[model samples]
Target: MSALPWMQHLIVVPVLLPLLVGALLIPVAQNRHGFKFAASAVSGVLLWLLSLALLGMADGGHWPDGIGVYLASNWAAPFGIALMVDRLSALMLVLTSTIALAALVFGARRWDRVGVHFHSLFQFLLMGLNGAFLTNDLFNLFVFFEVMLAASYGLVLHGYNLRRIQAGMQYVAVNLVASLLFLIGVSLIYGATGTLNIADLTLRVAALGPQDTYLLRIGASVLALAFLTKGAMWPLGFWLPTTYAAASPPVAAMLVLMTKVGVYALLRVWLAVFGDAAGELEGFGLAALSVGGMATLLFGAVGMLASQDGGRMAGYGAIISSGTLLAVLGHSGSAVLASGLYYLIGSTLAMAAFMLLIELTERIRPPGAALLAITMEAFAIEDKPEDPVGVGIPGTLAFLGLSFVACALVISGMPPLSGFVAKFSLFHALLAMPGRVPPATWLLIALMLLAGLAAIIALMRLGVRTFWASGAVTPPRLQISEVLPVGGLVALCVALTLQAGAVFDYLSRTVDGLARSGSYTERVLGEPPVMRPAGGEVAR
Candidate 1:
């Protein structure tokens, strides 16, 4: 049930590495950009490699309990603090580190120079994210959440632009209220259950009497509200597009993973505590999650249509991604949840790449030029030139145009890409369920399709005006550092598409592990429950 002596300590490294590096950078580097960049880049790659090792360990079945629970200072769970790594947490750790590395590399090109402590803030953000994913107890979750939020506030306002400051203020205010709600909810849960450990709560919640069950549900509902706000669900998400658009490209790319953190928390809590094992309290709030997810999708679709700025449109695309994952989670099926996990990875990578691409494509426009004039030039029909053209298209234009097309395909869920495969898998899961498919599922399908259509229309419009219509375009100077990150991310998406079968198999195992909440509960409680045979029981 224990990890190897050497690997046992690696659980804490993902969090400690970033925290120590960020703190060191602040004191040692200060205004030294090169040192800061080198430290962060090295730390990020190390974190990514560590995460992969953890994933391999978890997937390799090296742990007898089917979960890796690390107790701080040898303190036991439900008493002392704990950090747990399972398939889901390990997957998230890898995803966060990969994206963090790419964003750090992209920022190294220029954004790191725009402000002081850029590397410090970035490293702190990684620490928070890694901690949030790894923490096994509710209180530490809140602690890590605050750490991430604090770092994000600094990153959001890094440039100190007027618009960024304004957006940052609003972002700060909203998250502060959410954090307050989070604390209150956690307190209520602990007061009712007499424990703040998630695995402990899983055991306690199942045995609660009717009155305590009511209180637990109330506390959980409040917690869910806080998470939904962070997840940018419909009305609570109004600030997302503006905030994302206002932030610098690399920061915006990093911020895309923040919403996924909210999704991760919700999935962990709901499945571990309030799932079918809750007996009488099973299937709580399913209807609300479904409805809210649909509404968020519709709102994001509308916003995408209304957005004139490419950056803002990309922001709306992120909102749509959140909505899709939430809606799938609401279905509460293992197959659908597995598909959602795959989609989550693909959508996040695509969105991050899109955020980077937006800035690059937008920079192609000449300053102070009107968009209308560019549209006219782009769409103008003309006879073929009498003289043969030396080359079909300029190299810079070709590169930018190809990148834009890839972004458009991924965001809009077009064919032959990871996005399309994710969507197809989701739809297949929904339809494959027994009995009549719910009207809500149909509605989700319709909204998702419409959202894709809207994204296509909006992105095509922006692309045409920015690239095709604009006259005498002078391509922006792009460095290898900047281009490599974007290319790498897009390449990841393509890789995902090609290797989807293997990816889905891993996700299926992950879903199976998660569905056996009792095993997770037993493992964290240190009881080491008997392992069930494959295809035994499935969590509802």
Candidate 2:
């Protein structure tokens, strides 16, 4: 039930590595762009490698009961803070690292030059994301959430355009309110249960009496409001598409990951604190989550269908991703959750790559044609989806067009791609549930199908307009730096498709842990205080 000694040391590196590197970059002179790029790139790659190691450790079951707890400050949980990396968090770390590295490289070509401290803010953002995933308690979660939002505020406005400034203001203001709500909810929960440690909170929830149970529900709902806001769950998520559309491409791509952070926190907290074992409060908010998720799915599909700009459509695509995962999580079906996680990985990579591609493809249109496209889109007029067969620009157009096609196929869940496999797995799990599927779940199924249809129609329309409307346009030049990240992310989707069974098996085991998380309490609280290593070995 315990991890290897070196793995114990490695558990905390994801947080510390980025924290140190971000701080180190702050003092580097602005003109030393190449140096900063090299340092940040190295740090990102290392963080990614460390994440893979942790993923291996977690999936290897070196410590499921322990889940690779680091016991920061060398003391056990509920008495001293703990950082835990399980299969789920490790998976997230890898995804974030992959996306972050892509975004960093994409920006390096041009966007980084638009503003100073871009690289520094980028590292800090990664630190916050990794910390958020690793932290095992409510208090630290809030702290990490703020660190993430703070860096994102700057990144959202990195290029300092009118649209970004306006959108950034809304994004900042909304999250500030969400943070205050988060604090209030945490305070209420702590006041009622006298504990904020998630595993500890689960035990406390099971022991709560009648009055405290009522208070706990109220507190939990308020807390969910905060998370749902950040997770872009409709109504509350009005700020999402506009902000995503306005921000620079690389930042927007990472913002896709950022939205997932909210979903991640929600799922983590919900399962840890309110699992079936939690007496009376078990499955407390499942119905609400299902309903809200369905609504969010509907909204996203509508938004995608209604969208004109590629950026906004990509934003809507992200919202659709959130909605699908939330619905699956809310169903609380173990099989479905595994499939949903698979969907999460595929959709995230597609959207992130799509975000980068938007900026590149925007250049293909000449000034007059670009203006006309905007005007036409403004009026809700679009050309019929055309075949790319006859129209061809050999170099940049081919790459950009193919990337767009791949993104389209994945996002819309069409055949022969990972998206299709993920959705298929999701439905198989949903239908394979032991009892008759509930009416609400049926609704979710319908909505998911329609959502995919909307994506295909909307994205196909957009692609035709961008790639096929022209007869003989000059190909916009693209640097390898910009192209690699987008292509890399799209390639990941291909890998996901090729290795669907293995990936799904891994995620299945990961969610099985969530289904039976009771061991967390036993292992974490009982861990002995860690002592400094002597002569290349840990002393406990």
Candidate 3:
């Protein structure tokens, strides 16, 4: 394998593999379920393995500054499409592939059969996600963003019920507007800097005059709005809960990482292009980001309390996680950012597992029971029914119940879990800051505590209603395929908890390396540009 020709092209494989597989699967007949599942599963496993290898290479410093730059068609950076794999991007790729594999396995049981070309769409989505993470330029980022959004539109409506269609419509509308803003912002930035490559932009931004700097700031603000919308920031995020809730469980679980894409863009752009080197623009939007992040946290907390549906609750949990990360990034400290990265990974895993668990647990209730409860509450009616007491609960039920509790603890940032470790690290980072803590930082701390409290209350209520209330319990027929994914994610969270020191060390180094924009620029654009005649085409 090491001697293989394609092994040298590892960076592009993450995107190319999925794109080819998905495109090929489009022509396969739907009746070939065996072929579809086998193809998709094998692709998923290979993707996961590839991401692991990339992660190891990046973390082990096999590449210079833990950065691997791949030029398409042998064209130099800032001229042709380039893919960059660093510790941060590699980590994201690993997470994306891990979740993709789990979601595919879980959906293979039945959800994949509900729609034509499900596997194809899923693979395309993976391609888009991986490309978005790896692309070195904002233009390609927008392209990959649209690809991901398009695949998500299909997946969101995959199980095509009326409710899903309605939710998908809203989702589509919001993202379309976001995509437009993303394009406009990119155009503005390119106009200002004469380049779309992030590394080049970082160098160009430092040399801009006051007028161009103002324009660049405006462009960055517009881009930030686009990203904030996708990140589920308040006022722009009203569609998220309904959209996420409407999607099938496996799809919803996969969708958990989508918001992080926005967060990743923010971190990359902020640290690379707008860091301390951009004299006038240094920390230009941090204030707004912090304020918006706090608002998002507040919104998520209120929404969590108001939510009666498990899916909606999980969606709010995602919002909370996004908000926390946004606020921490605004702090502009490497330690805090490292802790935020840890929190980001832990929260995403816990939320994905919880989203998967919601569908399984909800199946245990009698049909229409939730609707009946709502109707009863609205009509001010109370009904208590006698229940048989001596029978023991099923093993599946107990497993799900315990899983739910673990998820709850993780989401709420309780003790003895990765979530708690992440929050604790954040707290320590905040306290360890060199200067006196600002009022805004204090407010962020307060909100973080409150958000956890809200999660605890909401999840406790949900647990009581679902697992403790008196009712006829209908045990859900659990499949090993479904159960394994949920368990695997939870186990990963536990692993993260146990390996916190090592993980934090890696993340800290990643953050430190990100602060050195010159190294990145040198590594990406140091090679000579490829010159071609006007009539000839270059192959990528």
Candidate 4:
């Protein structure tokens, strides 16, 4: 092969660029706020653009099977650390950059001013997120996971309030346990298979003898427990609402992406090692995944209805989003997977926007109002107007009200939005299967509809109380930085709705690529060593 162009190395840029910039920003003084913002903002823009290029490459089919693999230090795979990106990993990279940019802009408006090292922590988090998406080795993934978690620990406690600290402690404790589980699982797998590279594991698992198959299954189950805990499935996800509610809105918005990381890992690893290719291990744990997802969906919907606080409600909304993705992945159909990816993107954007919107909405509702309103409703009292004339809401109130409605519509999977389109596509695919729909699938369909209804009811109650029940509120002053990010996110969801056909086609292609895991294994394992500029000397 001819010498590779520098642009071919773009796969590493997403991970290395942020790591360099993050380290550079560490020594800069906090007083130099303008400098910090400029550096971080530039980094954010580059990461976004780089991700788009990578996404285009993955989708553009320039590489064989739309897969790109980078072997670090010019070493061969299954022996050296490797980085790989396909359609799914590239999609996640784009999502992370989008969310991180919005969070940076939102936080810089005020949250960064209150806290030290905010910019550095934010960039480090991005580095970890991108690294996690790219690494092909299991132990390398653990390294990136720690990098992500450590940055989040600081980011979660960014403002340093009592509530944040309390939530942060619990968050830390739970993740530590998860990390331990992750290690134990990795150890067992390594001991049994003699390799920690994910692609290599596929080869090992397929060739496993009867004795080793049992150990492989046990290790896989233990590993899944760790991912499920982070994925926020049912009983394992109790920490999400509290931590989300307590963190600053910008941080909370980023946390939404963190939760998806677990889902992404599960989807990637389970499909690679336990799908149809893995002989004895084929279809392992899928039933459990589906059941856990259903339970989580029901739990989150109920929690949304039960909670009065806006932040907590948004938190539960995140849980519902995760549940939907988990359930879909467990079902294992191409059409459903396509639609599920669509829903994942749309819901993530809407949920992040809602988390940011909560801070602004809370300003309009005075303390004790929620309690007093509940009491009045119970006692059959009314705050009736004597004249009974129409009242025009102020401009600020109008913006907040409309944004809240858009968010509610998207979250509840109502019509004329990406949320509805995604749900419609998913259900249509579910029933459109060739054979008769399973009884369990029917139950899943029913639960999904009820969950949407539950979200609608809960959000309607929130809207009534915040926008209507609490008399006229002075419109809070808004900042361009803050308002634009939220609007941008909502607008993206609207765009998703408008471009549903094209996006769905893209995702369908992605799902097709994912289903053929053979392509992934061949691309990563068969990739050649990097060529040197010198005469016929490759960096073996």
- Local accuracy of candidate 2 as per-residue lDDT tens digits, 200-288: 99888988888888888888999999999999998888999999899999899999999999899988988878887787787889778
lDDT of 3: 0.88
TM-score against native, each model: 0.94, 0.95, 0.94, 0.97
**Model 1, span 231-321: residue lDDT tens:** 9988888889999999998899988999889889988988888787878767677768888888889999999999888778988998999
Model 4 misplacement above 4 A:
333-335, 385-392, 531-540
Task: Compute the lDDT of residue 515 as modeled in candidate 4.
Answer: 87
> Candidate 3 lDDT, tens digit per residue, 299-415?
999999999999999999999999899888876445589899999999999999998899888887777777766666678776676564987879898889988988999999998
State the weakest 10-residue window (summed lDDT) of model 3. Answer: 1-10
Q: Which whole-number lDDT from 0 to 100 does residue 255 have in model 2?
A: 96
Q: Arrange candidates by TM-score, descending.
A: 4, 2, 3, 1
Clashes of each: 1, 0, 0, 0
Query: Which residue runs does candidate 3 get wrong by more than 4 Å?
Result: 1-6, 371-391, 527-540
Q: What's the C-alpha lDDT at position 85 in model 2?
A: 84
**Clash-forming residue pairs, model 2:** none
Candidate 4 at residue 187, lDDT?
A: 88
Angstrom error of the Cα, residue 260, model 3: value is: 0.5
